[model samples]
Target: MSDATSRKVKRFSESDRNSEFDAATQKALEEIDVCQNEIDSINEKSSEEILKIEQKYNRLRKPFYEKRNNLISNIPNFWITAIMNHPDLSALLDETEEDCLHHLTKLEVEEFDDIKSGYWIKFYFEENPYFENSVITKEYHLDSATPTSESTQIIWKEGCSLAQNVEANKPGKKRRHEPAKTFFSWFNDNVDPYTDDIAEIIKDDLWLNPLQYYLVPDVEGDGENGVDAEEVSSSEDDEEREGGEEESRNQRK
Candidate 1:
């Protein structure tokens, strides 16, 4: 037998119980707990400092975000395109919802005055046949590290309810246990705030850096031509600006 396998291991009987450690070992364990408490205290302070830092940057980013929204508004269907490009958000969208999202003009995320309190996700839409409301907002409020959310009720047009169109658990269907909720249904369902994947994905991923997703299709098409992604994205911005200027010039003419 190999030395590793041949080695005899000590096996203690179940009755071999010691409720107490030797004095030195017990003292050392107490000291270790004290050290861990100190470490935890440092971590708590660091978290507060980090939140202050985020609040500072968030204020600085506001004007740039506003300018970005203005610029993107010149690019038709910009919000819908970006939302569609996101893998997580795209999976939730069906063709019916995609049609509705085409009218989405702007998307905004705003943190509460107290950065730790929570944030809001706002979707602005042009006057569309799908819904009468001009905007829909979902706010996630954090209370003692627990999250809760509420959203604006959609005043959907007559006979144009996207949520009602979702088909689930039908016999003879290819996917019998398909998800009943469409992307539109997200506005209403808040059963488990912790498991609200759509809100989490949107707030964490898409809201942080939407420009990357906005240029996804352009980057894919330009990859074979040896064109840089940044260059393509820059060109897209330039084109949108020029298009806006041309529209203005035409109005004057």
Candidate 2:
């Protein structure tokens, strides 16, 4: 036998129950793998527990969500004002999206650091009968193009699947605002008709399902959701200046 084999055989102790019938190195490695499997099993159990907790949490929040939905139905321009309050999102939107915003029950945003993989936005609905598909998801691939603003931004990493799809299927000689052959464009044109030919069938369907209401809206509106840092700073500065002026006036009086 080889010297290595001789060493393994010498290391294996028949008297030691831990060694069993295997070599010392083999026994140690096998036990480590067994511990790792236990760890993995416990991790899976934790994941299951988290999912159960989330389901219960949703069930508890459903009543409040429905109550808010009812209030929104009664109060005109409720959602409109909410959307306009956010400076960044307001810039991207116009008056044309009023009707579409009404039926938009829920929007979920999942951000990924891997720019190549990009971000996923899932729109959930209560009763959208016009479209056969209930769920509409859009994936925006990160691009390395120059940002319009001078501030540092997380520009998308290019050459991913999202970019490739857009490049491969771009419409020939399209105008600046003209719709391209992207999945988002298709969703906007086919499902979300902002023009005169609006589909009431989907709206009526959504009206009956009270459980589809959402408490919090998505921050990312078509990828531009957050207000600029400068705007926030300016607002704070104005508030501070007003407070200081009021204090000085009170002292003089």
Candidate 3:
């Protein structure tokens, strides 16, 4: 009778233990389901937020598109006519087109060849007179031996700006002075919209000034170049010292 009683007690204890384990397992499974549902809900919300932001950006881009088209249409036809007429300018424009195509295809050149055209156009518009004016004037005296003879005077006159303004405001202005826009227009027209992945390829090719490149690093560390080599060595030394102190304390304890 005593042996049977002991056996029965052991069986009951085992049964209780099994029941507790099952309850714990069931709770854990429920928690996992709840966590999965929450994750799904968060992901759905994030996706919706992202879609809304994209839609907002798309709406904002509409104005820029309209402005770009208007600018293109407003471009004077005379420049195109001039480019067609002038052999040198025409050749330069053709070379620029070829270079641009090469860049779009291979992403090799950093700046478009039309950049030179733009510079020329800008110079033309500015009417810089450096090319035509020969006025000689001295302002400073170089030597003390003959004050009058050594007096240096610089002859400066506005040449290009005057010419550029005159040309730009002519009664029937035919040329486009804005080089950047001209280049952009040429790019849009010549490149295959579907196949030219140049935009994606060139997205990261933006010209960053030295300061801009390391702005964050400058803020966090010593300057744009980052903490000097000496500073880095010093920091390492400090860390080593702290580690040694920690080990020493542990040993003492």
Top candidate when judged by lDDT against the true structure? 1
lDDT by residue for model 3 (1-253), tens: 2354445445545565556557667556545555666676789899878767756765666476445534534443423333333323333344443332222211111222222111000101112233232221112121344321111122225432212232342324453433312333323222122232222222222111111221223233463366676787888899999999999999999
Question: Which parts of model 1 are misplaced by more than 4 Å?
Answer: 1-19, 165-180, 218-253
What global local distance difference test value does model 3 have? 0.36
**lDDT per residue as tens, model 1, 1-253:** 2232222111111212452666566556555655666676789899999988998999999999899899989999887888889977888778988999999999988989778887888999999988888999978877666567777878878998776532332223353223336676666654445667778778888877888888886435555488877788899999999999999999999
**Highest TM-score among the candidates is held by which one?**
1
Q: How high is the CA lDDT of each candidate model? A: 0.75, 0.44, 0.36
Which sections of candidate 3 miss by over 4 Å? 1-26, 68-97, 100-199, 202-253
Which candidate do you rate higher for TM-score, 1 or 2?
1
Report the lDDT of model 1 for residue 113. Answer: 77
TM-score of 3: 0.24
Model 1 lDDT on a 0 to 1 scale: 0.75
Q: Sorted on lDDT, highest at the top, how do the candidates line up? A: 1, 2, 3
lDDT of 3 at 102: 25
lDDT of 2 at 97: 42
